[model samples]
Target: MSFDHEQRRPADYAAYGSDIDAGLQAHMRRVYNTMCIGLGITGLTAYVVASVPALASVILTPPLFYVVAFAPLAFLWFGFSPQRIQRMSAGEATRMFAIFSGIMGLSMATLFLVFTHESIARVFFITAGTFAATSLYGYTTKRDLTKMGSFLFMGFMGIFFASLINMFFHSAAVHFAVSVIGVVVFTGLAAWDTQYIKESYRYNAMDDSANARLAITGALRMYLNFINLFQSLLSLLGDRR
Candidate 1:
């Protein structure tokens, strides 16, 4: 998918370009709105689970806790992947996104149990501000972010492996290092995903179903960036109760 500039454009082209720009803006707004709603659901669900001992007992136990932790991964693979979700209609994708968001919230409840509310809120705002800044840069910049996407993905994989090793080793230093790298990787990812989503917009396609699928996909990407960024910041800066 490429957009080429002739450097010397025609009058007709500019008029058509204005219409496309409006469509792209509208599409981007939908993506962001959907992402915000999903985040709200996740945050609410997490808080509720954390506050209720009965829910916590059911969810936070050894076997169940493991399931809760891994469920979101399962959802991403089976439920939210492009091969599956792209084939899905707008309603179907929205429902799947909602379910995945809830699963993510269940996984995140452990954070509430482990950290103070004040610290969580503080780190969340920090992540939000950082995400907003980098994502804006991505959207507005003329430079392509495509090259960095693969490298950032590799960094994410490295962090993943280091985290798994640290889980067994119980190493604070390793964990701290992982958190730092995670922040960097996800920050880059926020920018890369934004640019990717922005560039994906085509001037010609106006199919509502296709647009909806794109919006859901974009929402999922941004949601992931926000959640991971918040978690990383929490690990680094959050004070324990």
Candidate 2:
């Protein structure tokens, strides 16, 4: 009996390990799928707003434009507040994310205004490829990314302040530097976020509701990374209209 129990223990452990691996994969797939849907919504919204002269005239104009520009920030601050997140159902979270994606699209409609369509498309592909490779590295690499993520976060904050200052100075040099640094920061963030999301599955997998919320939030993080990366690369590589 002792020998038989010992033999079964190893198989039980192996089966448990396999279950965990499968769960993690499914969680990651959910995260990626949600992120892709958000991206699609944002892209479709941006294209529609940019292509329609009536929509552009209203949205890209002064007062409404400010609303469009800051709406996503508003949602992030108020909609995703700690209390709100705790109470938010999976359905509500999904809807909120969708709305935020559309608002981001409105803000990003300026990209279409500033860059040629062909150049935008080209730079987008470049950004996509770069993001995928970096995220894959983050997912597969055994090395801890927590330290690297911390360093990159500080760099990101520096550039954020630098960008605000440049808004007043209108310095081309600062703009160029920020663009370059932004690309690097956001690209690194993509990897860091992927690793974070991958690791978070263990805790979140116990509850369906928790896992659903995690997927939405994870998607939002990755979506932001992709968007920032695309914008930074576009500024550096895109041809203006």
Candidate 3:
């Protein structure tokens, strides 16, 4: 009887472990799916907007150029505001994601005008490969990335401030420095954010509504990280048209 009980306990534990693994995988899949859809929307919107001669012309006007350039930052600030988003429904959050994607696409459409098509495509694939590898490491590794998060956040802020100052200075050196730092900062953020998102699921898996909110939020975070990384890498590596 004692031997039988011990054997049954191991079987029970194994089954429980398998179930947990399956659930975690499904959760990760949902997060990635949501992010991929957002990226698709953003890319399509950018392409469409860039291809419209009249709209592109309008956006290139000085006053409108500034607005188009800064719109992504504004949307990001609004979308990631926890206090503001807390009151929002899941549908509302999803809508916000779509709106934010469109705004970002509008801003990034200028990239099509600035860089050669071949260079843009080349940089995009490079960015995609790097992002995939880093994110995979973050998701699969057992190491704690919590410490890396703070360092990366600081680096991002530094890059942000430098980029802002360089806007007025118009220094090519400054631009090059900012691009390099931006790529590094965002690459670290991609890994750290991926791990953080996964851990968040472990913490909030029990509440269905909370899980839905978290899924959307996680998607938003990862999407932004991926987009920013790609843009920064492109700035560094892409040839101008």
Candidate 4:
């Protein structure tokens, strides 16, 4: 009787474990899907805005240009402040993601004017490949990336400040250095954020509200990382138009 119960217990545990794994994978898929959709929206909007003469003219106007350029920062601030906007729903989150993507697309339209089409395409593919590989490694690796997150965060902030200062100084050397460091910082962030998102799913699996928030937040983080990395890499490698 005892032996029979023991054998059944193992089988039951195995089945339970399998179910949990499947659920976790499905949740992660949702997160990635949201991120992909956001990226698609951003890309389409960018192309349309850049190619339309009237739209480009409006966006490139001095005042409108500053607004479009700074729009991403505003969206990011709002997105990060969930506590201040507790009434926000998942649908609202999705809408925010769309709006943010559109803003980013408008900002990125400058790339169309600055870089050769072929070079931009090449650099985009490179960024996609690198992001995929890094994210996959983060998801599958057994090593914990949590410890590296703080260090990477500090590095990102430092680089961000330097980049801002360089805009005023207009230093070519500073720009080159920022691009190189920006690539490294964002690359690290991509992996760390992937791991953080995966672990967050495991931690909040039973809470639907938390899970929804995590999905949107994770998507936003990954999307930003991808855009920043792509821009940095493009600056380093792309041929100017």
* Tens-place lDDT digits, model 4, residues 24-130: 78877887898889889888888888899999999978989988888888877866444523356778887888888888999998898889889989999999999
Superposed by TM-score, candidate 2 places the C-alpha of residue 196 at a distance from the truth, in angstroms, of: 0.7
Tell me each candidate's TM-score.
0.93, 0.92, 0.90, 0.91
Q: Candidate 1 regions off by >4 Å?
A: 1-9
Q: Model 1: which ten-residue window has the lowest total lDDT?
A: 1-10
Model 4 steric clash pairs: none
**Candidate 2 Cα deviation (angstroms), residue 47:** 1.1
Instruction: Write the residue-wise lDDT of candidate 1 on 1-241 in tens digits.
Output: 5444544458768877887888899988998999999999999999999999999989999899888988998888876886687899999999999988898999999888899999999998999999999999989999988899789989998998898777779999998998998899999998898888877777324677777898899999999989988899899999987
Task: Order the candidates by lDDT, highest first.
Answer: 1, 2, 4, 3
Which candidate leads in TM-score?
A: 1
| Alpha-carbon RMSD, each predicted model | 4.6, 2.4, 3.2, 3.0
Model 2 TM-score, 2 decimals: 0.92
Give the Cα RMSD of candidate 2.
2.4
